[model samples]
Target: MMVANEDVQVAPTRGRPATLSADGIVDVALKLLDAHPKDELSMAKIARELSVSPPALYRYFPTRTSLLNAMSAAVFADFPEMPADRSWREQLLAWQNDVAAVYERHHGVMMLMGWDDQLAGPWLKVQMPVLTLLHSIGFSRLSLVETTSWFLAATVGLIRTYLAADSDGLSRSDLIEFSEGLGGLTDAQRMLVEETREWISRGDPARILNLGFEALVDGVERRLGSLQAKGHI
Candidate 1:
């Protein structure tokens, strides 16, 4: 279900100053969230950023989840509309790149999303276009729903996994030092690690993410081909 654009943002409370408006709180929270881990961006931290007490923030957001949902709205508010002229495949690739850019920019914002489905505006903003394209290509209602779910899961999973890996993966020096310790391994195990060391140690996150996404789209295309062979369309 797509949440309306307005439904994701926090509404202003009466009596708050413009500087302490709902949008203001969301903006500060997003900035703090980007700089810190999701769990660290508490209401108190946001309040400190704004030079106010936690209670003052509660007047607008009321709870940390509300503020996080509003921040999500702010992040996705500028999600671009898909180009009308592209083929379905072209649009799917373009959409994957664009969505990757957002997740890359915000880093860990996915974890901050509200659990309540009512706050799903950011999700649908990125999801609905692909689902619509698949539907246009003759995916049945059940297939459409199932395929869209898999598409979302795969896209988000690859991006999140790579982002974490890119940041937390060993440094070059660390990798070299760790390689020394691998002498204790069996001959076959050591040979495998030596053969794949560079690839594993320096996985190009963007390239891997794009490849994973493209592979997913390729599966969708193959499924379309199978259905066409049966004259299902």
Candidate 2:
């Protein structure tokens, strides 16, 4: 679920001048992000929202990317550690769901970070925990980088694609037609129907996203089986 936007921030000192600490700045910046839609957020907008000079805002975050990194860090700081009691597949799916929730809230934050190659630390904080869980689970057919890339492509890539399309309004009819047009495919209708069933059951960004999650978990199980057969785990 999406979080409600809160009141505009002031210096937290109560009566006297509230110090514009990094945390406070981040608080206000996050507010601005929530209040505005994608591409509408900027340093100027944030400064105006906070009633601070743009240069004053720049003092802490030298560039817009830097401030965004801080915002991403602040968001990631809340992600829970991996659940030790759960199986590795369970833990990894749960972590990806949590990451998806955060990315949904922030919308384009990750894309912005990608644009500048910024905030490697917080970004890795999300990736490493899951990768470590996979490693602990004995997944080694693909290198960590390869597995991580594939997982992100499924989860984050799906989210970005949905957002870009304004909720993946692409009709499954088209998909089914395309599959039928692929020539001699015996199970084309069944395959496309099964794939699009979740989408048909509900709406974009959640139903389809859950399907992607299941696919990732299935991939992990397959990799685990392969490793076990080879005595690699």
Best by lDDT: 1
* Model 2 per-residue lDDT at 166: 23
RMSD in order of candidates? 6.3, 8.1
Error of 2 at 48 (Å): 1.6
TM-score of 1: 0.77
lDDT of 1 by residue, 79-190 (tens): 7777769988778878877777776677646754445544356766667888888898788777788777787778777666656522433122223444667969999998
Q: How many residue pairs clash in each candidate?
A: 0, 0
Q: Model 1: how far is 133 from its true place, Å?
A: 0.9
Best by TM-score: 1
In the predicted model 1, the residue pairs found to clash are none
TM-score of each predicted structure versus truth: 0.77, 0.66
Question: For model 2, how does the per-residue alpha-carbon lDDT over 1-233 read when each residue is reduced to its tens digit?
Answer: 11122243544323322576678888877765544434456666666677665556656777656766777788778888878898777787788778767766664455433444343578777778877776766665465566667876677766555444222233232233344454655587668756776565356546667777888878867866876888766
What are the Cα lDDT values of the candidates? Answer: 0.68, 0.63
